[model samples]
Target: MNKRLLWLLFSILFMAGCSVLSSTDPEFSRENYDSWYDKGEYQKALNHVNERLETYPEDALLWNEKGYILISMEQYNEALQPLEKAIELNAELDSAYNNKALAYNETGEYEQAIVAAQKAIDLSEEEPEQFINMGNALSFLERDEKALEYFNKALAIDANAPYAQYGKGVSLYFLGKYEEGIPYFENYLHSYPNDIDALWYLVYSYDTLGDYMETIPYLNQIIDNQKENPINTVDYKGLMLTYAGELEEATTIYDGIIEQYPNEAIGYYGKGVLQIQQGQTDNGLQSLEQAVALDNSLKETAYNDPLLSSVYNDELFKRIVE
Candidate 1:
């Protein structure tokens, strides 16, 4: 009887010890999962989370962390399950809701994202980042006016909010208030000189306002910063050819581009403009025809092209535009 009792006691003690060890373990599974996440091995991180969930099913923080990892991977649909579970476990987990909204936004579910973002904003109180995120969600929903309001709110909370200022500029640009947009873009550039999107918008705004001269310096800066960025070089060349009146230099650059990218429509279009500017009618018409055949998208601007304006009444020009 004593032998049996001793064995039973040993078994009970062993089981108790195992339970304590498991409970006191530093969540090594979560640590491994995070390591995978930091390495950009998102699928591996998610698999680790699933394994941990089997052992710690009631861990709300683990579920929310998993949701954040899934959102980073752009696995938006898959992210919803864990995030919803997190919200169910702890209604006050603001980051879970914020991550859920990000996932919704990634999946193009803008309305749902807006609802989720609003919840996050309520939880965040006066946080500027939350307001900026809310503005982004509103922008995706085509509620530009409301988006601008949120952007302004974000700026009020944090005057140097880059995302908010950039959002405001984009909204204003879409609303056709280019003049209002320009200052915001300029402000963003003052702090973020390497912002390619802002630089592109600044160039576009100046071009639209017939202040092409002002755009040249920024384009030059972009080219200097990014040596291999072909788009900036091409845009700069086109703008210089149009407004700078350096036909000979423009011709040389366009010819080089055409030789490098024979099938590219922009190079042909550029060359055609250069030819027309030099009074080479037949060559210009041929180059323009090649450009149109390569990509008909250039047709809209062909008529309004300053170089082609001189030949507006020409029969060949009419045929090409038609």
Candidate 2:
């Protein structure tokens, strides 16, 4: 009776310790892969997967997972090998086909992406991602009508699928259906609010439609989200404000640009044009001279600009530009 009780106690303790043991030993647990991956420790996740593969090289799931890890690392070329290997090991591995399509898409091999995505779609049901992959590749190939069909298939599967909406938007945008594309981008932004590409699409659509004022707010949003200096975006906003007749606001933008980037020829060039338009010709001429000194090309631009026509005959302006 005592021996039986001890055996039961030992079994209970061993089962209890198993999870803790597996959490440490990468060789003993698959959960560690997800633990590292879920935390965005992609290199650690890759290392863990690679370490396990050294022993269980035939493991198809691990091979597929390794491919996914490489994709997450943006190592698209490296991802293809393991993804192919996974499919070789298990012909029915739908996930491997999907991942292979994604890697091919990033590498600019659109035909291969479409082929792999087709395979994934055939192997799985209700998977919008594969449809999106095919749509993206077809769109890249200038097969907009065909691509639209696939995007529509994805949308039919999930009406609110953001990626499908984005893909459809891209097709329509390229096809000159800017007005129709607007709703799809808007739908996509509903899910991915700050998506830079979608925001730029909206900007272009509004600009192309001659709705200049509509573009200003979106441009401002893009400028605000820029991680780098955003000097170009700031210039765009300043130009847009000028077009909107918000002269004071535009002047402030130019001043800010000059202060932030003192050596930038564009800031001085923009400031000089605004100054000329606002009848600050003397100050404008000086700024234009400085701009021409920094970038000789702006001399030709100043000569051609209608805003400086009033000062065209000015001796100082002729000395600065002509």
Across residues 156-270, which tens digit of lDDT does each residue of candidate 2 receive? 9889988889888888887889899999989988987876677878887887786767878788888888798899878877776766677798899999999989999889988
Candidate 1: how many backbone clashes?
Answer: 0
The per-model lDDT (C-alpha) reads: 0.71, 0.78
Instruction: List, residue by residue over 1-322, the lDDT tens digit for candidate 1.
Output: 1211111111100000000112222464555755775687877777776777788887766787687776767666988998899789777666677777667766777688788878877776566665666676777666878988988997898787676778788777767788898888788777778766677677777777778767776776676677574753664656565676767767777877788888888888888877888889889988998999999978877988766889899899898888
TM-scores, all models, native as reference: 0.74, 0.78
- The stretch of ten residues in a row with the least summed lDDT in candidate 2 is 10-19
Task: Give the residue spans of candidate 2 off by over 4 A.
Answer: 1-35, 51-56, 279-286, 299-322
Off by over 4 Å in 1: 1-55, 186-196, 216-236, 244-249, 289-306, 319-322
lDDT of candidate 2 at residue 14, scale 0 to 100 = 9
Report clashes for each candidate as comma-separated counts. 0, 0
